[model samples]
Target: MPSSVPSFAELLNQCERSAIHLELRDCYASTERFEAWKRGERIDWEDRESWWHPYDQLIAETVARGVSVRRARIVSEPVSEYIRWEHYVTHANVTAGEEVRWLPRRQATSISLPGNDFWLFDGALLRVHHFSGDGVVVEDEITADPETVKLCSAAFEAVWERALPHHLYTI
Candidate 1:
C-alpha cells in the first residue's frame, strides 16, 4: 500500500526519538520576513507573545513531549543577506527548543549529500523539500526508501558533527 504523506507539523507531532532537518540552501524565499529584514526591521525577541503565537507553541509543546528537534544548514562562507537575517532570527528557534547548527559549503565538498533539503523523523521517514532556482519552495516529498534514508542519515550526521552551533555561527 502507498503510504499517505503527512504534513510537516504532523511529522513533528509524531516524532518519538528525533526530528532532524538538513538544509542545503543559503537563502529561502520566505517573503514577508526577507522584506522586513531588507527594510532593517528586526524581530523584537522581547515581544514573544506577538511573533510566536502558534509556531513557537507547537515546537515548544513537541519538545516538551521529549522529541528532539535539530536543524543543520549548509551555507556559503560569505552568506547571503537572507542568512544574516536568518541567523539573527534563529534565536526564536532556540527559544522554541530546536537545536540548530551551521556548516559552511567549503567544509562539505567531500560529503555525499542529498540533492534536496529533508527532515528525517525518528530515523525512519524522510520528507524532502524542493525549492525553485530563486529559492522559493516548490514541493515536499515523503519517502521511506531504505537506501535514501541511510544516505540522508549519514550525510546529516557528518554535517552536524562539523557544524557550529547556532549561537557561535556568525554570518
Candidate 2:
C-alpha cells in the first residue's frame, strides 16, 4: 500500500474500463443532508437541478467516457435510518449513469469481503477506506498489490451478482 493515496477524483479520471465500490457499513457519519432527510426533508424528484451534486456530475462524465461505474452496498436487513435515506437519494446516482445495488448482510455471510470498504479502479489500483466506529473516514490506503486487488474485485463481483438492483430493492 502506498502512503500517498490519490484523491477519488484522480483515480476516477485515471480509470479506463471500470470502477466498483463496495460499502460494507450500515451507517456512516451523519451529514447535514442526512439530518435534513431524517427531519422529513425530501427531494422533489421532478426537480433534477435542485438535488444534482458535483459528485453526480463526475459520475456522469466518467460514464460518458465509457467507464462502468458501479456501487454495491452490503447492509443489514431491517435497515438503519441512514440506509433508508441513502436508498432514497440513490436516484441521483442512477440519473448520473452509475449502476447501484444493495445486498442484505445476511445474504453475504459466506462471501469473503475485505475488512473495510473499497473502491477498485480498473481491477488494478485499490483505495481501501478505513473508517472510525463513528463512521468518519480515518484513512485512505492505496494499493496495487495483485492479491488485494484480486480479492476486492472478486468480492465486489460476488456482491453485485447476488444484490438486487436499486429500483427493485425495498426498505
Candidate 3:
C-alpha cells in the first residue's frame, strides 16, 4: 500500500493492455439509481441516453483504444437485492465493452482470494478497495508490490475461469 492512491479514472487512464476487477462482496451500499430501481423505477432499455453514464463513456473510450477490461464478481446466492439489481443492470457494462462475469461463492470455496476487492491494471498496478462491513467503500490502497499483484492477478484469473458470463448468469 502506498501513501498516495490515484483515482479510479486515473488508474484506468494509465492502463494500457488489460485491466481486471475482482469483486467479492455480496452487496454494496445502494446508490440513488439502485434505490429508485427498488421502488420499481424501470429504465427504458432501448434508450441509451437514459441509461448510459459518464463511466460507461469512459469504458467505451478505453475499449475503443483496444484495451481489454473485464470484471468478475464472486457473489453468494440465492442472491441479495443488491446483487439482483447489479445483475439486471450489467448490460450497461457489456454495452460499454467490458466483459463481466459472476461466480457463486459456493463454487469458489477452493480458490484463494484476497481480503479486499481490487482492480489490477496490466498485471502490474493494483488498487485495492477497502470496505466496511455494510459494503461501503472506506479507502483505496494502491500498490505495485510483486507479491500482491501476483496474488490478485491469480485470484482474478481463477475466478474468471470458473465464472459464468453475464448473459448466462441468472439471478
Candidate 4:
C-alpha cells in the first residue's frame, strides 16, 4: 500500500494485519530465527538474526490473534538443511499444522519480472535491480505498483502448489 518495497519486518507486520502468505526461494536466515524462537532461545546477534526475529513474533502473535500464517519456501541442498533445522525446532514448539508449506527446488518455479524490482539469491550472490515507475526503472528503483505486488502473490502460489507435506520430513 505504501509506495515502497516493504522491508522484511514490514512485510511480516503486514501479515499480522491480515492473512499472510510468503514465498521464500531460500530461507536460511528466516528459518534459523524461527528455530531459535521456537526453542525460546534469545536470538544471536553476531550472525544474521535480525531478519527473522520480527517474523517469528509476527507468526506467533498472528496465531494468537486468530490469524493464520501460511508460508511456502523453496528448499534444496543447502536450503534443505535450513528446512530440516526449522522443522525440528518448530515441531518442538508447535505441532505440525497446515500453516507452513515447504517446497524442494526441483519442484519450484522460476520467477521472472516484467521489470527488475526483484532480487535473486543463488546461495551465492544476491542481485537486486532497481526499477522506476515506468517499465523497469533502473538506478532509481523506488515505488511499486499494485500489479507488481499481485505478481509477487501469484509467484508465491505457483510455488506453494508444488510444496511438500511437512510430515514427509523427519523434523
The per-candidate count of clashes, in order, stands at 0, 0, 0, 2
TM-score of each: 0.94, 0.97, 0.97, 0.49
Error of 2 at 86 (Å): 0.5
In candidate 1, what are the lDDT values of residues 1-171, reduced to their tens digit? Answer: 554677778888888989899999888877887798799887777888767857778889999999999999999979988888888888888999999999999999999999999999999999998899988877888999999999999999999999999989976
After TM-score superposition, the amount by which residue 85's alpha carbon in candidate 3 deviates from its true location, in angstroms, is 0.1
Candidate 1 least-lDDT 10 residues: 1-10
Who is ahead in lDDT, 3 or 4?
A: 3
Each model's lDDT: 0.90, 0.95, 0.93, 0.47
Candidate 2 per-residue lDDT, tens place, 1-171, comes to 555777899999999999999999999999999999999989998998899998999999999999999999999989999999999999999999999999999999999999999999999999999999999999999999999998999999999999999999999
Clash pairs, candidate 2, are: none
- lDDT for model 1: 0.90
The residue ranges of model 1 lying beyond 4 angstroms of the native Cα positions read 1-4
Cα error of candidate 4 at position 163, Å = 1.2
Name every residue pair that clashes in candidate 3: none
- Each prediction's Cα RMSD? 2.3, 1.9, 1.9, 10.1
As for lDDT, the candidate ahead, 1 or 4, is 1
- What is the overall TM-score of model 1 with all chains considered together? 0.94
lDDT of 3: 0.93
